[model samples]
Target: MTTRPGRGRPKASDGADRRTALVDAARRLFAERGFAATSVRAVAREAGVDAALVSHYFGDKQGLLVATMALPVDPAARIREVLDGGRDGLGERLVRTFTETWDPHEDVIAALLRTAMTGDPEQAPALQLARAVLVVGVREQLQGPDADGRAALVAAQVVGLAVTRYVARLPHVRDLTPGDLARVYGPAVQALVDGN
Candidate 1:
Protein backbone atom coordinates (compact mmCIF):
# COMPACT_ATOMS: atom_id res chain seq x y z
CA MET A 1 0.00 0.00 0.00
CA THR A 2 1.07 3.56 -0.76
CA THR A 3 0.54 6.61 1.40
CA ARG A 4 0.25 10.21 0.26
CA PRO A 5 2.96 12.67 1.33
CA GLY A 6 2.70 13.65 4.97
CA ARG A 7 5.04 16.16 6.50
CA GLY A 8 3.73 15.35 9.96
CA ARG A 9 0.13 15.06 10.97
CA PRO A 10 -2.53 15.25 8.28
CA LYS A 11 -3.09 18.71 6.84
CA ALA A 12 -6.62 19.92 6.91
CA SER A 13 -8.13 21.72 3.93
CA ASP A 14 -10.41 23.37 6.43
CA GLY A 15 -7.49 25.29 7.92
CA ALA A 16 -7.40 27.83 5.10
CA ASP A 17 -11.15 27.91 4.87
CA ARG A 18 -11.41 28.41 8.59
CA ARG A 19 -8.90 31.24 8.58
CA THR A 20 -10.85 33.02 5.84
CA ALA A 21 -14.05 32.56 7.76
CA LEU A 22 -12.44 33.92 10.92
CA VAL A 23 -11.06 36.97 9.16
CA ASP A 24 -14.36 37.72 7.49
CA ALA A 25 -16.16 37.33 10.77
CA ALA A 26 -13.58 39.43 12.59
CA ARG A 27 -13.85 42.21 10.02
CA ARG A 28 -17.57 42.40 10.45
CA LEU A 29 -17.30 42.20 14.22
CA PHE A 30 -14.56 44.78 14.41
CA ALA A 31 -16.72 47.10 12.37
CA GLU A 32 -19.68 46.41 14.58
CA ARG A 33 -18.09 46.19 18.04
CA GLY A 34 -15.29 48.66 17.45
CA PHE A 35 -12.45 46.15 17.95
CA ALA A 36 -11.66 46.62 21.66
CA ALA A 37 -14.85 44.94 22.66
CA THR A 38 -14.52 42.02 20.28
CA SER A 39 -12.74 38.93 21.53
CA VAL A 40 -11.05 35.99 19.86
CA ARG A 41 -13.48 33.71 21.55
CA ALA A 42 -16.36 35.69 20.12
CA VAL A 43 -14.80 35.62 16.67
CA ALA A 44 -14.20 31.91 16.92
CA ARG A 45 -17.80 31.35 17.95
CA GLU A 46 -18.96 33.35 14.99
CA ALA A 47 -16.66 31.51 12.64
CA GLY A 48 -17.87 28.17 14.04
CA VAL A 49 -14.36 27.07 14.89
CA ASP A 50 -12.85 26.13 18.20
CA ALA A 51 -11.09 28.98 19.94
CA ALA A 52 -7.78 27.14 19.67
CA LEU A 53 -8.05 27.26 15.93
CA VAL A 54 -8.09 31.04 16.00
CA SER A 55 -4.77 31.06 17.87
CA HIS A 56 -3.39 28.37 15.60
CA TYR A 57 -4.23 30.33 12.46
CA PHE A 58 -3.39 33.85 13.62
CA GLY A 59 -0.91 33.31 16.47
CA ASP A 60 -2.92 36.04 18.13
CA LYS A 61 -5.36 38.86 17.42
CA GLN A 62 -2.82 41.22 15.90
CA GLY A 63 -1.69 38.66 13.35
CA LEU A 64 -5.28 38.07 12.36
CA LEU A 65 -5.86 41.78 11.86
CA VAL A 66 -2.72 42.13 9.75
CA ALA A 67 -3.70 39.16 7.65
CA THR A 68 -7.26 40.32 7.24
CA MET A 69 -6.55 43.82 5.94
CA ALA A 70 -3.58 42.64 3.87
CA LEU A 71 -3.09 45.74 1.80
CA PRO A 72 -5.33 46.05 -1.22
CA VAL A 73 -2.19 46.93 -3.17
CA ASP A 74 1.08 45.12 -3.70
CA PRO A 75 2.93 47.33 -1.22
CA ALA A 76 6.48 46.10 -1.87
CA ALA A 77 6.26 46.74 -5.59
CA ARG A 78 4.66 50.14 -5.15
CA ILE A 79 7.24 51.26 -2.60
CA ARG A 80 10.00 50.12 -4.95
CA GLU A 81 8.42 52.21 -7.69
CA VAL A 82 8.46 55.22 -5.41
CA LEU A 83 11.99 54.77 -4.04
CA ASP A 84 13.50 53.83 -7.38
CA GLY A 85 12.09 56.97 -8.99
CA GLY A 86 14.93 58.92 -7.32
CA ARG A 87 14.84 60.47 -3.87
CA ASP A 88 14.77 64.20 -4.63
CA GLY A 89 11.47 65.90 -3.78
CA LEU A 90 10.17 62.48 -2.82
CA GLY A 91 8.31 63.89 0.18
CA GLU A 92 5.74 65.77 -1.85
CA ARG A 93 5.54 63.00 -4.36
CA LEU A 94 4.91 60.41 -1.69
CA VAL A 95 2.32 62.55 0.08
CA ARG A 96 0.57 63.32 -3.18
CA THR A 97 0.73 59.75 -4.34
CA PHE A 98 -0.47 58.17 -1.08
CA THR A 99 -3.23 60.68 -0.39
CA GLU A 100 -4.46 60.47 -3.96
CA THR A 101 -4.55 56.71 -3.80
CA TRP A 102 -6.26 56.50 -0.39
CA ASP A 103 -8.65 59.44 -0.84
CA PRO A 104 -10.82 58.05 -3.59
CA HIS A 105 -11.94 55.27 -1.29
CA GLU A 106 -13.06 56.82 1.97
CA ASP A 107 -15.23 54.01 3.24
CA VAL A 108 -12.48 51.51 4.01
CA ILE A 109 -10.16 53.99 5.67
CA ALA A 110 -13.00 55.60 7.59
CA ALA A 111 -14.06 52.28 8.98
CA LEU A 112 -10.51 51.51 10.05
CA LEU A 113 -10.02 54.93 11.63
CA ARG A 114 -13.25 54.74 13.53
CA THR A 115 -12.32 51.38 14.95
CA ALA A 116 -8.82 52.46 15.88
CA MET A 117 -9.88 55.64 17.71
CA THR A 118 -12.31 53.71 19.81
CA GLY A 119 -9.18 52.05 21.24
CA ASP A 120 -10.47 48.55 21.03
CA PRO A 121 -8.13 45.58 21.11
CA GLU A 122 -9.90 44.27 18.06
CA GLN A 123 -8.82 47.29 16.06
CA ALA A 124 -5.20 46.37 16.77
CA PRO A 125 -5.34 44.08 13.79
CA ALA A 126 -6.11 46.86 11.33
CA LEU A 127 -3.65 49.35 12.81
CA GLN A 128 -0.85 46.80 13.01
CA LEU A 129 -1.73 45.45 9.59
CA ALA A 130 -1.27 48.87 8.00
CA ARG A 131 2.00 49.41 9.86
CA ALA A 132 3.41 45.98 9.01
CA VAL A 133 2.71 46.39 5.33
CA LEU A 134 4.38 49.81 5.23
CA VAL A 135 7.47 48.78 7.21
CA VAL A 136 7.98 45.72 5.04
CA GLY A 137 7.52 47.71 1.84
CA VAL A 138 9.88 50.57 2.66
CA ARG A 139 12.58 48.64 4.49
CA GLU A 140 14.50 47.91 1.31
CA GLN A 141 14.98 51.58 0.53
CA LEU A 142 16.97 52.49 3.59
CA GLN A 143 20.75 52.99 3.68
CA GLY A 144 23.27 51.69 6.30
CA PRO A 145 22.77 49.25 9.15
CA ASP A 146 20.47 51.57 11.07
CA ALA A 147 18.08 51.47 8.13
CA ASP A 148 15.30 49.86 10.14
CA GLY A 149 14.87 52.89 12.38
CA ARG A 150 14.89 55.29 9.44
CA ALA A 151 12.39 53.17 7.59
CA ALA A 152 10.14 53.01 10.67
CA LEU A 153 10.29 56.75 11.15
CA VAL A 154 9.36 57.32 7.55
CA ALA A 155 6.52 54.88 7.80
CA ALA A 156 5.25 56.63 10.91
CA GLN A 157 5.25 60.02 9.20
CA VAL A 158 3.54 58.64 6.16
CA VAL A 159 0.91 56.91 8.24
CA GLY A 160 0.43 59.89 10.54
CA LEU A 161 -0.16 62.32 7.71
CA ALA A 162 -2.60 59.90 6.23
CA VAL A 163 -4.47 59.64 9.52
CA THR A 164 -4.45 63.36 10.26
CA ARG A 165 -5.45 64.61 6.84
CA TYR A 166 -7.72 61.84 5.75
CA VAL A 167 -8.83 59.74 8.71
CA ALA A 168 -9.20 62.32 11.49
CA ARG A 169 -10.18 65.07 9.05
CA LEU A 170 -8.42 67.72 11.12
CA PRO A 171 -10.30 70.86 10.06
CA HIS A 172 -7.79 73.48 8.89
CA VAL A 173 -5.35 70.85 7.76
CA ARG A 174 -8.08 69.05 5.90
CA ASP A 175 -9.21 72.08 3.91
CA LEU A 176 -5.75 72.92 2.59
CA THR A 177 -5.14 72.61 -1.14
CA PRO A 178 -2.78 69.94 -2.43
CA GLY A 179 -0.16 72.59 -3.15
CA ASP A 180 -0.52 73.92 0.38
CA LEU A 181 -0.17 70.46 1.82
CA ALA A 182 2.98 69.82 -0.17
CA ARG A 183 4.46 72.96 1.35
CA VAL A 184 3.47 72.30 4.96
CA TYR A 185 3.50 68.51 5.23
CA GLY A 186 6.15 67.75 2.67
CA PRO A 187 9.08 68.83 4.84
CA ALA A 188 8.02 66.68 7.76
CA VAL A 189 7.55 63.62 5.62
CA GLN A 190 10.79 64.34 3.83
CA ALA A 191 12.72 64.66 7.07
CA LEU A 192 11.48 61.25 8.10
CA VAL A 193 12.66 59.72 4.84
CA ASP A 194 15.88 61.69 4.73
CA GLY A 195 16.71 60.59 8.31
CA ASN A 196 18.14 63.91 9.44
Candidate 2:
Protein backbone atom coordinates (compact mmCIF):
# COMPACT_ATOMS: atom_id res chain seq x y z
CA MET A 1 0.00 0.00 0.00
CA THR A 2 1.25 3.45 -0.90
CA THR A 3 1.63 6.00 1.85
CA ARG A 4 -0.87 8.85 1.66
CA PRO A 5 -0.21 12.57 2.08
CA GLY A 6 0.42 13.38 5.75
CA ARG A 7 -2.02 15.49 7.76
CA GLY A 8 0.55 17.05 9.98
CA ARG A 9 -0.12 20.72 9.28
CA PRO A 10 -2.30 23.05 7.31
CA LYS A 11 -1.42 23.69 3.68
CA ALA A 12 -0.13 27.01 2.39
CA SER A 13 -3.53 27.84 0.86
CA ASP A 14 -4.69 28.39 4.41
CA GLY A 15 -2.85 31.70 4.48
CA ALA A 16 -6.09 33.67 4.67
CA ASP A 17 -7.29 31.44 7.46
CA ARG A 18 -4.02 31.93 9.28
CA ARG A 19 -4.32 35.71 9.01
CA THR A 20 -7.82 35.55 10.42
CA ALA A 21 -6.62 33.35 13.26
CA LEU A 22 -3.90 35.84 14.08
CA VAL A 23 -6.39 38.71 14.19
CA ASP A 24 -8.77 36.75 16.40
CA ALA A 25 -5.92 35.83 18.68
CA ALA A 26 -4.77 39.43 18.84
CA ARG A 27 -8.26 40.64 19.70
CA ARG A 28 -8.62 38.14 22.49
CA LEU A 29 -5.20 38.84 23.96
CA PHE A 30 -5.64 42.57 23.62
CA ALA A 31 -8.94 42.32 25.43
CA GLU A 32 -7.68 39.97 28.11
CA ARG A 33 -4.17 41.32 28.70
CA GLY A 34 -4.33 44.70 27.01
CA PHE A 35 -2.10 45.66 24.10
CA ALA A 36 0.97 46.60 26.09
CA ALA A 37 1.12 43.33 27.96
CA THR A 38 0.40 41.06 25.01
CA SER A 39 3.58 40.02 23.24
CA VAL A 40 3.91 39.03 19.59
CA ARG A 41 5.17 35.62 20.59
CA ALA A 42 2.19 35.13 22.85
CA VAL A 43 -0.19 36.12 20.07
CA ALA A 44 1.54 33.72 17.72
CA ARG A 45 1.30 30.94 20.27
CA GLU A 46 -2.36 31.68 20.81
CA ALA A 47 -2.89 31.47 17.06
CA GLY A 48 -0.91 28.24 16.93
CA VAL A 49 1.38 29.71 14.27
CA ASP A 50 5.02 30.66 14.19
CA ALA A 51 6.04 34.06 15.49
CA ALA A 52 7.49 34.86 12.08
CA LEU A 53 4.01 34.51 10.62
CA VAL A 54 2.77 37.33 12.84
CA SER A 55 5.58 39.53 11.56
CA HIS A 56 4.93 38.46 7.99
CA TYR A 57 1.23 39.25 8.24
CA PHE A 58 1.03 42.28 10.54
CA GLY A 59 4.55 43.78 10.36
CA ASP A 60 4.43 44.47 14.13
CA LYS A 61 2.20 44.91 17.16
CA GLN A 62 0.80 48.25 16.01
CA GLY A 63 -0.22 46.75 12.70
CA LEU A 64 -1.85 43.94 14.62
CA LEU A 65 -3.66 46.53 16.77
CA VAL A 66 -5.19 48.06 13.68
CA ALA A 67 -6.24 44.65 12.41
CA THR A 68 -7.76 43.67 15.77
CA MET A 69 -9.91 46.80 15.90
CA ALA A 70 -11.48 45.94 12.53
CA LEU A 71 -12.30 49.52 11.74
CA PRO A 72 -15.08 49.83 9.19
CA VAL A 73 -13.09 52.26 7.03
CA ASP A 74 -9.44 53.12 6.57
CA PRO A 75 -8.81 56.06 8.89
CA ALA A 76 -6.17 57.75 6.75
CA ALA A 77 -8.21 57.50 3.59
CA ARG A 78 -11.30 58.81 5.35
CA ILE A 79 -9.28 61.69 6.81
CA ARG A 80 -7.99 62.56 3.35
CA GLU A 81 -11.53 62.49 2.02
CA VAL A 82 -12.75 64.79 4.77
CA LEU A 83 -9.88 67.20 4.19
CA ASP A 84 -10.00 67.15 0.38
CA GLY A 85 -12.77 69.74 0.08
CA GLY A 86 -10.78 72.15 2.21
CA ARG A 87 -11.60 73.30 5.76
CA ASP A 88 -14.75 75.21 4.89
CA GLY A 89 -16.99 72.39 6.10
CA LEU A 90 -14.42 70.28 7.82
CA GLY A 91 -16.36 69.84 11.05
CA GLU A 92 -19.56 68.71 9.37
CA ARG A 93 -17.61 66.47 7.07
CA LEU A 94 -15.80 64.97 10.05
CA VAL A 95 -18.97 64.41 12.04
CA ARG A 96 -20.71 62.79 9.10
CA THR A 97 -17.76 60.66 8.21
CA PHE A 98 -17.12 59.47 11.75
CA THR A 99 -20.72 58.67 12.58
CA GLU A 100 -21.31 56.97 9.28
CA THR A 101 -18.16 54.95 9.57
CA TRP A 102 -18.97 53.82 13.09
CA ASP A 103 -22.72 53.41 12.86
CA PRO A 104 -22.51 50.00 11.28
CA HIS A 105 -19.98 48.78 13.79
CA GLU A 106 -21.54 49.95 17.02
CA ASP A 107 -21.03 46.66 18.79
CA VAL A 108 -17.34 46.57 18.02
CA ILE A 109 -16.89 50.21 18.92
CA ALA A 110 -18.79 49.81 22.16
CA ALA A 111 -16.70 46.84 23.18
CA LEU A 112 -13.49 48.73 22.49
CA LEU A 113 -14.76 51.78 24.34
CA ARG A 114 -15.63 49.66 27.37
CA THR A 115 -12.21 48.02 27.34
CA ALA A 116 -10.54 51.39 27.06
CA MET A 117 -12.56 52.85 29.93
CA THR A 118 -11.29 50.09 32.21
CA GLY A 119 -8.17 52.13 33.11
CA ASP A 120 -5.92 49.12 32.81
CA PRO A 121 -2.41 49.98 31.67
CA GLU A 122 -2.68 47.13 29.20
CA GLN A 123 -5.42 49.07 27.43
CA ALA A 124 -3.07 51.88 26.51
CA PRO A 125 -2.35 50.42 23.11
CA ALA A 126 -6.01 50.31 22.22
CA LEU A 127 -6.46 53.88 23.42
CA GLN A 128 -3.43 54.96 21.45
CA LEU A 129 -4.75 53.33 18.32
CA ALA A 130 -8.05 55.17 18.77
CA ARG A 131 -6.28 58.47 19.37
CA ALA A 132 -3.98 58.00 16.40
CA VAL A 133 -6.90 57.52 14.07
CA LEU A 134 -9.12 60.28 15.47
CA VAL A 135 -6.71 62.92 16.75
CA VAL A 136 -3.98 62.54 14.15
CA GLY A 137 -6.46 63.34 11.41
CA VAL A 138 -7.62 66.48 13.17
CA ARG A 139 -4.07 67.60 13.97
CA GLU A 140 -2.99 67.08 10.39
CA GLN A 141 -5.87 69.13 9.03
CA LEU A 142 -5.86 72.00 11.49
CA GLN A 143 -3.74 75.14 11.04
CA GLY A 144 -2.80 78.25 13.06
CA PRO A 145 -1.98 78.54 16.79
CA ASP A 146 -2.46 75.71 19.29
CA ALA A 147 -3.09 73.16 16.60
CA ASP A 148 -2.53 70.42 19.11
CA GLY A 149 -5.05 71.90 21.53
CA ARG A 150 -7.56 72.39 18.77
CA ALA A 151 -7.09 68.84 17.63
CA ALA A 152 -7.57 67.62 21.16
CA LEU A 153 -10.76 69.64 21.52
CA VAL A 154 -12.08 68.32 18.24
CA ALA A 155 -11.19 64.76 19.23
CA ALA A 156 -12.95 65.18 22.54
CA GLN A 157 -16.10 66.42 20.86
CA VAL A 158 -16.31 63.58 18.38
CA VAL A 159 -15.34 60.97 20.92
CA GLY A 160 -17.85 62.31 23.39
CA LEU A 161 -20.51 62.17 20.71
CA ALA A 162 -19.61 58.55 20.00
CA VAL A 163 -19.69 57.71 23.68
CA THR A 164 -23.10 59.20 24.18
CA ARG A 165 -24.66 57.88 21.03
CA TYR A 166 -23.10 54.45 20.91
CA VAL A 167 -21.61 53.45 24.23
CA ALA A 168 -23.93 55.13 26.64
CA ARG A 169 -26.93 54.59 24.38
CA LEU A 170 -28.39 57.90 25.41
CA PRO A 171 -31.91 57.73 24.13
CA HIS A 172 -32.12 61.29 22.82
CA VAL A 173 -28.81 61.23 21.01
CA ARG A 174 -29.34 57.67 19.84
CA ASP A 175 -32.69 58.57 18.33
CA LEU A 176 -31.33 61.21 16.00
CA THR A 177 -30.57 60.26 12.42
CA PRO A 178 -27.06 60.72 11.07
CA GLY A 179 -28.05 63.75 9.06
CA ASP A 180 -29.74 65.29 12.05
CA LEU A 181 -26.59 64.60 14.06
CA ALA A 182 -24.44 66.30 11.45
CA ARG A 183 -26.73 69.33 11.50
CA VAL A 184 -26.87 69.47 15.28
CA TYR A 185 -23.28 68.60 16.13
CA GLY A 186 -21.41 69.94 13.10
CA PRO A 187 -21.34 73.57 14.21
CA ALA A 188 -19.71 72.71 17.53
CA VAL A 189 -17.03 70.67 15.79
CA GLN A 190 -16.66 73.43 13.18
CA ALA A 191 -16.01 76.00 15.87
CA LEU A 192 -13.24 73.91 17.35
CA VAL A 193 -11.69 73.22 13.95
CA ASP A 194 -11.97 76.87 12.99
CA GLY A 195 -10.28 77.89 16.23
CA ASN A 196 -13.13 80.16 17.20
**Which model scores highest in lDDT?**
2
Overall lDDT per candidate, in order of appearance: 0.68, 0.77
TM-score between candidate 2 and the true structure: 0.61
Off by over 4 Å in 1: 1-77, 116-130, 144-146
lDDT of 2 by residue, 1-196 (tens): 2222334555565544768888888877776666677899999888777778777888877778777777665656776688777778888888888788878877566657766776454644656765777687678878899999999998899789988987778997888888888898999999988888
Instruction: Provide the lowest-lDDT 10-residue window in model 2.
Output: 1-10
Q: What is the C-alpha RMSD of each candidate to the true structure, in Å?
A: 10.3, 7.0
lDDT (10s digit) by residue, model 1, range 117-165: 7655564465666567667656665566667887788777876776777
RMSD of 1: 10.3
Model 2: number of clashes? Answer: 0
Cα displacement (Å) at residue 87, model 1: 2.6
Error of 2 at 42 (Å): 24
